[model samples]
Target: MRNLLVFCVLFSFIFFNSCGEPSKKKEENQLEEISENDNQEKSESGVILFFGNSLTAGMGLDPNEAFPAVIQQKIDSLGLPYEVVNAGLSGETTAAGKNRISWVLSQDVSVFVLELGANDGLRGVPLEETRKNLQEIINTVREKNPDTKIILAGMQIPPNMGQEYTSEFRNIFPELAEKNDVHLISFLLEDVAGNPELNQGDGIHPTAEGQKILAKNVWEVLGPVISE
Candidate 1:
């Protein structure tokens, strides 16, 4: 009787341990599977983030009407495998953009379109400061994702700021693009700027019609980059 009791106890202990081991392993495998699924989703849904000020935000227009949204439509139409995230903030300056860039780059960005410095120029922030801020932004993006394709949008301030400052500001984008070996959009506003019909009442933000032109301007450079 004593031997039979000891044998029964040992059998129970072995049975429980054997069951527990597989359960623990199964739970571990499930957790690993979930982690892999999350990574796959992130990889498949890589984003093309448009980070900038009011122009990128599409101020005074419906959220869908923004140039970034317009670009999203275009991307969808073409059946591209990327999502567009409009990270534009109205009235944002270069200094503000520099401060926020690190947080903005936390996501996985396949393509980064930077449209800033217009507010800095309008506010008459130091030209050198603007250039530095822009360079830092590019650097931060590169650090986050070396493979991310960058497109720098050029901006121009009104002559009221002075020719020297405007010229320097205008040169900042191309110089940064060439220095960093990134794509450059010669002028963000292009045909929209100085056109009363294309601008909002403030003569700064683009009208809906103007947003289309802005979309076209971005698409010209962006389309080829994404295609490659």
Candidate 2:
């Protein structure tokens, strides 16, 4: 009779443990699933992406001084529900921007600011190629997020590139904006460009002060879109 009792207790212990093991594993799996969903939800939230070159990168200044960061500050103050992602890379050309656009678009984007082609124009890259690359970049962004609001930052190259080339380069931004039906910032550097106080020693990238102006330029158009 003792042997029978011992067998029954051992069976009960084994059965309970076996049942508990699956329950523990299921709880762990559920927690893991919940974490993944939370991460995905966070990523899908509204994102304002600034994809461009050195000017956008804030080369000579701190990252926080970058126009995109400045824009973020404005967004925060307004209590807007958007995050800014500065994907700027120094010396980035239209072709390079186009090439890496897919990777940038992988994340959810509510607003996309395109600030490219300046380097391409400076390098004397073919106008047709530059236009084509810019167009493709716009197309890819639209394809990735059909509802994303696109803002094109127009840039001007030095006159040394010759009157005709410079004119054509200057015209690209507006042309592309018109074709794509996107908002355009006529001149990104407006009051900042050519001003030694606003630019770095290199006379190219903007200084911290210059970036503030740039941010305002972006915000003028961006604010309306986000408010909507």
Candidate 3:
């Protein structure tokens, strides 16, 4: 049935990314733990958590190639006082993200970029459910830290799911951003999507060159927020 098919798709998507997991710790995580002696060194970095799915995790590519890592490199170049944590799960839906968000927010976050719901849209998950789950995630972030700046990455899917469904899915990101009063990325994929050269053989995840574009897209909105 449809439920089984959805599960299969999710599993396959996750499996594809699982192949690249050994390098995640080395490339995606940038938390700094200064020793007491080093505490005098100064510069306590706040965390910038990038929470989402495969795209955020940089599936099919090196973790360093992911946009979040790219953002971290940018932050380092400018000497920003923030660490970037890539919490992207390949098969994550908004509902799945909600279940794990509390633990993820255990550390204080200066900026949170949310990039989920693409899997939901692809699997034809109910639009209302997707919207509600995303709202909950946003709410959880605010509750965890009232001062944490949020950036919601917008996602869009093809019309294979019908015009109404596709349109509703596309609108979820901006509507939630407006309703929650947070920064919005407009379209996370932007120029990267639907471009054959920019994507992998799967024609979904972006290539290394494409990730550079993704980094640019995120920096456009993120640069100002972190700089502010």
Compose the digit string of candidate 1's lDDT tens values, residues 85-112: 9999999988899899998888789999
Model 2 alpha-carbon miss at residue 208, Å: 0.4
- Candidate 2 accuracy as TM-score: 0.82
Tell me the tens digit of each residue's lDDT in model 2 across 34-144: 667678757756999999999899997899999999999998898887899999999999999998999988887899999998899888999999999999999999898
Best candidate according to TM-score: 3
Question: Candidate 3 residues 68-127, lDDT tens each?
Answer: 999889999998888899999998999999999999999889899999999999999999
Provide TM-scores for the models: 0.82, 0.82, 0.83
lDDT per model, in order?
0.89, 0.89, 0.88
- Supply the TM-score for candidate 1: 0.82
Q: Which portions of model 3 miss their true places by more than 4 Å?
A: 1-37, 40-43
Cα deviation in Å at residue 148, candidate 1?
A: 0.9
lDDT of 3 at 77: 93
